[model samples]
Target: MAAWQAALKWAGEHWSPAPHLHFVPAQQEDLPMVEALAREIWPQVYRELISADQIQYMLGLMYNVPHLEEEVRTRGVRYQLIREEDGSMVGFLGWELEAGSGANHSTALLHKLYVKPNQHSRGVGASALAHVIAEATIAGASTLQLRVNRQNRKAIRAYLRAGFEFEEDRCTDIGGGFVMDDHVMVKRL
Candidate 1:
């Protein structure tokens, strides 16, 4: 079978019908819902890795409706919703293609992947990642890159299982006296 066919089959098996998971691009109208989910999920997910104050700060910086809308409309980052067959949103992903770096394939940044804490370990993350891979591949990106907090072992393990390798360590000053200390992970498409 062709590579694309194999990918399609894999996605179908893991996400279509049986698993009842679907990835859909977010629209402007979906901003409020996405913001609500992010607010619900981020605190629990980041609690162990960051302080409460930082969590609130980051949430405001990233998940506010205005910021999300700007990201979707102006920044060209794609926001995808993870939904169940029953039409419930469980998670979301963000990515954007980086073009013209003179590489063999374009690089896409996998900005965010958040699954509701209660829904972890149910293959939700893996399926969501696979969907992103297929989407990035279709968009002509040869690599997908993301950063995880250095102390986020669970997420690191997930990325490893999803075929990503640690690329480097990074520290970014995101203003407000906070810094994101992270390990950059990359998956080659």
Candidate 2:
């Protein structure tokens, strides 16, 4: 079976009434849809955590079509749109596998995982994360790591619930006079 198919089966056994989610690999033609979802999700999610200027700047840097295309086509990053069985998009996530220094060890960097505001509290996020974890494991990653803004308490809680522990604090100056004050979280596979 495909890795994700096994992951879905595992999720069904783990999460009650598991989320009927399908992870569709995003292509060049799908950039516009991903951008639209980002435009819709980021503001509502970061409104209280960061400034409007920062939000717009980060959006332009990360979600613009050209940048996304480059990340997918040239950078080895993988983007997947999360959808329900009924063919509605509910969320999206981006991830990439980073080779560790030695053989038999690697890390999966989860760059983005955002669900629609209205879908909060449902199993969509959890299921998506479970799927990623499974895929990473199948890909031989020994760890899964992500960065979450320090002030985003809700996301922090969710990560904690998913077995991720705070590893360290990071402040990255992503140009444009804006810095990301975040906590690096890691989960062992």
Q: By TM-score, who's the top model here?
A: 2
* Segments of candidate 2 deviating more than 4 angstroms: 1-17, 99-101
lDDT of 1 by residue, 73-110 (tens): 77688998899989999999999987454456689999
- Over 96-164, each residue of candidate 2 has an lDDT whose tens digit, in order, gives 888342457888999999999999988888888888898889878899999999999989867776778
Least lDDT summed over 10 consecutive residues: which range in candidate 2? 4-13
RMSD, one per candidate, in order:
5.7, 6.5
TM-score of each: 0.88, 0.89
Residue pairs with colliding backbones in model 2 are none
Off by over 4 Å in 1: 1-18, 99-103
